[model samples]
Target chain A: MRQDIIEIRWHGRGGQGAITAAKVVANAVFKAGYKGVVMAPTFGTERRGAPVFTSLKISREKIYDLSPIETPDMVVVLDHTLLEEVDVTHGLKDGGQIILNTPKAIDTYDFGAHKLSISDVTSHALEAGLAPGIVNTGIIGAFAKATGLVSRDLLREAILNEFSVMKPEENARAAALTYDRTVIGGA
Target chain B: MHVIESGNVAAATGVKLARTQVIAAYPITPQTPLTEKLSEFVESGDLPAEYIPVESEHSAMAVCIASSTAGARSFTATSANGLLYMNEQLHWAAGARLPIVMCVANRGVGAPWTVWNDHQDTVSQRDLGWIQLYCADHQQIHDTVLKAFKLAETVSIPVMVCYDGYLLSHTYMPFDVPEQEKVDAFLPGFEPTHFLNPEKPRNFNTVTLPDVRPDLHGNTAPGYMEIRKTLHTDLRAALSEIEKIDGEFGEIFGRGGEPFLEPYCCDDADYVAFCMGSLSYQLRDVVDAMREEGIKVGVMGLKVYRPFPDAAVREALSAFKGVIVLEKALSYGNQGALYADVKSALYSAETRPFVHNYIVGLGGREIKTQHLYDALTESINKEAAVGDEPRWIGLKL
Candidate 1:
């Protein structure tokens, strides 16, 4: 009963695709045979460049709570700069996980009592010719591999379902590259 | 027959399945997507309807009333001040008794200004005379709209399908989008009880003296008092009809339950939390956690807020040791509107438990489950007393 629901919160700028990514993850996870997946994109008054938060709840049982995620199991950030401005780790579980879009060494940052996973998500998305600031898919790939919340293949399908890429192979390669390059360890 | 989408799209899907012929819309906040999706359906030739893009919410509802008067199944969507802008016409539709269906993506009314979620906008218009139904999730949002059309047309009363602005409107979940044929079978075509037919011209509600009045044709019609009383009588009768329609809806769509009060885990509950819309979902989680901790607690969700389900409220709360009213809305000088009705419901009941109102999440402040958990624990341990003042739960004061 304790782990019946896994709540994930995404922190990104308003123009960023975290909101879409959250919905994609919800679609992906549900299609992958999970039950009662709920995704909520925060409808704040904030405009572009301002921080926006989105939440997802995956549960085998029907999820009743439709409120904001006060306590999330995992926190995913699209921009590494947001780590300083926003409380990226706010209200996360005791041993919760944090997946960040960064290329720095894991030991350089310290998030006590929570596990951390890192990838150069923005670089991968930019390298793949995906729109800048839309690093959600790249980090989502890092997220799937780091937490095993969803499979790598389904995440790619979800991404492809969302965007009809011109160089589609690079899109798949972007996810695979981020997935393979993700580093998981101490917070 | 199934789809994963936001609650707004679910409502639009219901509008499509109900075969709404005329849709009048002026986009507002969370409700914008609802009309947007319907417009897309019309533009895409998927939903065969005339989509009227109006300039304001007042005109939007006016257009709906006009369409319904012309004997067409009409639909519209609005929120917050947009709802308030249509205040006078809301009464007009009710008085005229047009079976127009509307989707109110409930949000906090503005002064300080907010685009976030709450129930204040819809609850404040309680006396505007509509069959108000609050939905708990995306699926219910879709289901209730279908039921709203059926219930509204059955009784010739307007119905508003309400849900928390962004909480349900923007949230995504898997829902069984009912078969179009099945919905078509369940909901019959719009048969207007009273309509404006140009062939038969007559003035409506122009004037009525205190006594019975005779028309040009020597037919007697009741006065204002009886007309007002009859509307309420028919509305009260609509409460029962809603249950019947719900049963028939279940037979066809297999998605029917109690259309009034939904009591959960309350056989021997020491406390039962009462709420409406998505907030109640959070309260349900708290109830389960409390139950797991050996505390007997449950939740009672309000499906139909209008016609005030007094008997059901009395029966549900009389068994619990205490009743906690969780409201995302307030009545200014008074407490939550639900708190007032709940207090009145228990006043005549044989048993009176401790009753309190936790006015949480007003103006879209985030209401976590722990805040509700703390409030419930406090209410259960306190006296079996009732008060006019509500404890402002989670307010920074």
Candidate 2:
């Protein structure tokens, strides 16, 4: 397949930092001298544990339309339970990749994608003494490995810009571990 | 200094400049970013305030009421369903007469839910006894927040600073955020004479006996009579305070649109259109085009919706042959509610013009300038038909 702009759809709960993940990705794209549209399609009252989806459209051109992406190029499931909550693979294009946050085997569920379970994301974060909320940074690292859409240097720069002020060294360690263990499943 | 900012950010900056001490809010569409930005200020140590992440909109208003009564400059914001959810405390905020400034990003209330710009949310709260100030642009959003605090505190009533949901909330424009020290000098910290302090405990909303009931109004009796008089008097008081606060704010902020009614091309016109909220800006554009074509039409925007600003409206509209009231909200029985009030204001004038009411947007429907232009074009033909009652623009069959 020809390499082009990568569109990512993030699925997770409200307080799971899904929105922040999209922003980090956008910031990464922006630092790469590209454009990224970070949009969160929120509904009803903001309740904890409610399923929330945020989208990031990273392109070399200016991103204008913010509507829901019918066919996302890459789908990052921040919460594994959201798979049963809605059809996560509804309009996912063929040859697209799915990055499940769980460690279970990809074929354990019938989700129709070349799936890889980045299960070590949480444990590695915990190993680094980073709390559970840093899974998003791990997801970014796995995303960079899976898609190769963004440079590791650019993603590292974006993560540092975002979280370096809060928890710097632990997140940098988490990003390094994530970049190493993210293995590609069957295509 | 002029900075490019979203309407939500602009309003938040206004609240920060006003030195709001407490912000209790639950996030809602078109309004979440306003509070989110304020929360950022609190987190970044830029603004020193209590940002309470409330459970629901009801609790949001409750927090605002309690905090404001305790001598704090409190603020909260919501849109659509969130405002409707805060229904009961809306009455409490007014009944207790707390001067809480709320920014209402006007949205459509739902059954079949929608998240778009409309006047349903703010318009439905017209009878809640709070002063309503509709804004036209980003500058007005900043001006209205500062003025609203003064008006609310002066009238001893709450005030709603309303703007179109997405039109103003999401759009970015150049905003002039005043210096904090200058704003502090303009609006000193509020110190309440009566607070829920442990040392000076007092009953807030207690039941009164019949004999003492009449004392609330003194000259006027109790029930609807006294309530109406109090509302009218308080609303009139709010209008004067609105003008006075605008003058002071103008001195500090250096931009002064009319604090009450903004008249556009009304001087030498035979016909005029009355609109509120962001539509007035759209109407002004139409008025300019019509003026260039020598249509002799003008635009009048109502900012203070409570006191009705009757005199200002009558003086500006009396010279026209007919007046067109473009309403986004409706009263089931009569004409557009504001049109009825405007008619009452114009009734005794010597040369009263004919009034036409065009109800265009209800459930967050898009209202184009052409729709307004079409309504005016129709009114020009049917001016004589409108005697006392007004006409609807795009009523559903």
| Per-candidate TM-score against the hidden true structure | 0.93, 0.67
Q: Which candidate has the highest TM-score of all?
A: 1
Query: lDDT tens digits, residues B112-170, model 1?
Result: 89988888899999997788999888888999999999998988889999998988899
Q: List clashing residue pairs in candidate 2.
A: none
Best by lDDT: 1
Clashing pairs in 1: A111-A187
| Worst 10 contiguous positions by lDDT, candidate 1 chain B | B383-392
Cα-based RMSD of the predictions, in order? 2.5, 9.3
lDDT of 2 by residue, A33-105 (tens): 6642334344335578888776666667533233346678778887677788966666777877777776665
- The fraction of correct interface contacts reproduced by each prediction comes to 0.77, 0.00
Candidate 2, residues B48-116, lDDT tens digits: the string is 999999999999999999998888989999998999999999988887778999999988878778787
Point to the candidate with the largest DockQ: 1
For the second chain, the TM-scores of the candidates in order are 0.97, 0.92
